[model samples]
Target chain A: EDQVTQSPEALRLQEGESSSLNCSYTVSGLRGLFWYRQDPGKGPEFLFTLYSAGEEKEKERLKATLTKKESFLHITAPKPEDSATYLCAVPFTSGTYKYIFGTGTRLKVLA
Target chain B: DVKVTQSSRYLVKRTGEKVFLECVQDMDHENMFWYRQDPGLGLRLIYFSYDVKMKEKGDIPEGYSVSREKKERFSLILESASTNQTSMYLCASTQVNQPQHFGDGTRLSIL
Candidate 1:
């Protein structure tokens, strides 16, 4: 069975602080790994996708890095507007058109 | 931009009533997905349609059914709503093996 687990269910950070969130997974034949940000009362917004190990993608203050068994979403100098639930998901080779998602990490950045 | 539109943002209905949640995508994507988001469960896929008149079951499809009469529209049907079915429903559309675009989501509450 494919499973995804995210660490630090909640994180509170001060302005200009830096941190990283972990997303570990166990699946067969990973096709893609995705990162999304979701605010309260809204749907998730796409952020980045990593397709292979040692791959990294960046956007503004966020950088996503992928490894064989895990992925990390690194935030540098976060702001209040960056506070949201960060989710990670992986597409498997089972041809289900489905993604296995993590429980997500709620980030709260104080200004 | 790919815009996915959900029919409602907030809805309340009786437990035994039948419910319909509609979604439309203007990007003419070939894949449409239905998912329910809970507090601790992240997002669980309920159903998805690859093309017009073709549907596939996801991880949780026991209490849900879907319809795709056209390429841009997909509907989720609840034959008999239950208290356990109250959740934040999300709709998404994408091309094959591409990033997904999401709607604003519908928060459904069953009385």
Candidate 2:
């Protein structure tokens, strides 16, 4: 079965503190990985997509890196505005549109 | 910008009643998806549509049905609403092989 697991269910960091969130997967064929940020009372916002091993993408203070079996979302100098639930997902199959999502990591940035 | 619009931000329906959640995307995307997000279960796909009148069941499609009579609009219907179906329902749309864009989500409560 294809599954995605995210570590550190919750995290607290001071403003400007940097950290990385892990998303490990066990699937037959890796097609792509997606990162999203969801705020309270809102749906998730698209962050990045990594397609292959050693692939990386960045936007503002967030960076996403992908490997053969896992992906990482690294936050740099995160602000209170950046405090949200980070979710990672992978396609259920090589060419299918269905996605398997992780439980997400809730991060709180203290001012 | 891809705009995915869900019909309601919050909804309340009685148990055993029929419920409908609507979603529309303006980006002309070919794929539209419906998912429910819970505290620990993450996002579970309920159904999806690849084209007008073409629907596919997702991992958790039982007790729910979907309609996509138009290319940009998809609707999820619950035959009989249950307490377990009360969740944050999200709708998303995207082109093939592209990152999905999501709506603001509809928080549905069953009484």
Candidate 3:
């Protein structure tokens, strides 16, 4: 069975502090890994997509890296505005067009 | 900008009532999906459509049905609302190998 799991269900960091969030998966085959940020009372916003091992993508203060077993979302010097639930998702299979999503890591950056 | 729009931001209904949640994407994406999100559970797909009039059941499709009468529109229907079904409903759209774009979401409540 294909499944996704995230670590440190919640994290609290002071403004300008840096941290990393983990997403691990178990499946027969790998397709793609994705990252999303969701604010309270809102839907998720797409962040990055990683296709293969050692692949990395970056946006603003966030960076995402992927490996065979897991992916990491690294936040560098984050701000209070970046406080949100970070989600990890992957396409189930090539043709299925469905995704297996992790439970998400809720990050709170205090001012 | 790729924009996915949901018809409602919040909804309230009674148990045993039929409910419909509609989504439209302006990006001309070939794939559209319906997912129900809950805290600690992440996003669970209820259905997805690859093209007009084409639909596929997702991991949690019980008590739910979907329609994609056009390329840009997808709808999720609950045959009968239940308290347990109340959740944050999300709509997403994507093209081949592209990152999925999401709408603001619909928060549904059943009483």
Candidate 4:
């Protein structure tokens, strides 16, 4: 079974604070790793997709990095509007379009 | 912009009642998924469809079923609404291993 785990269940930060969220996965074959940001009372918004080791993608103050076994989401000087839950998912190469999701890390940015 | 839309922003159902949650995506994607989000569970996949009329059970599909009769529309059905099933339901669509675009979500409550 494909499994995903995320660290730091909850994070509180002052405005302009920087931090990183971790997403680790164990799967037979990794096709892609995805990061999403979900706000309260809304669905998740797509953030980044990391395909291969050493791959990285950035959007605004968020950067996502990928390795063989894990992915990292780095927030640089985040603002109050960046407060949301960050979710990570992995798609396996077993010809299934299913994605296994991590528990997610809730981020609260205080202004 | 590729947009995904859910039918309702909030729903209330009585116990033992059947409920349906609808989702539609404007993009011509090949895959669609339904997920339920709770406080600590992050997002749990209820079902996924790779193509029209093709459905697959996900990790937590026991109490839920899905229908994808059209390429742009997917619906999640709850056989019998339960208090435990109350949560925010999300819908997403994608092509293969690409990142998915999600709807805002439907908040369901069972009385």
DockQ values for all predictions?
A: 0.73, 0.79, 0.76, 0.88
Candidate 2 achieves a global lDDT of: 0.92
- Residue B55 in model 3: lDDT: 91
| TM-scores of all candidate predictions against the true structure | 0.95, 0.94, 0.94, 0.94
Q: Can you write out model 4's per-residue Cα lDDT over B1-111, one digit (the tens) per residue?
A: 889999999999999999999999999999999999888767888999999999999889988888999999999999998999999999999998788889999999999
- Residues A13-105, model 1: lDDT tens digits: 999999999999998888888899999989999999898999999999999999999999999999999999999888755767777778999
Q: Give me the runs in candidate 1 sitting further than 4 Å from their true place.
A: none
Candidates in order: C-alpha RMSD to true structure: 1.3, 1.5, 1.5, 1.4
Candidate 1: interface RMSD in Å?
Answer: 1.1
lDDT tens per residue, model 2, A44-105: 99999999999999999999999898999999999999999998887777667777788999
- Of 1 and 4, the candidate ahead on lDDT is 1
Q: Of the candidates numbered 1 and 4, which has the greater DockQ value? A: 4
Evaluated on CA atoms against the true complex, candidate 1 attains a DockQ of 0.73
Best by lDDT: 1
Error of 3 at B85 (Å): 1.8
In angstroms, the error of model 4 at A34 is: 0.9
Candidate 3 deviation (Cα RMSD): 1.5
Full-model lDDT, candidate 4:
0.92
Model 2 regions lying over 4 Å from their true place? none
Model 4 TM-score relative to the real fold: 0.94
* Model 1 CAPRI quality: medium
Question: Candidate 1 chain B: minimum summed lDDT over ten consecutive residues — where?
Answer: B93-102
What TM-score does chain B get in every candidate?
A: 0.99, 0.98, 0.98, 0.98
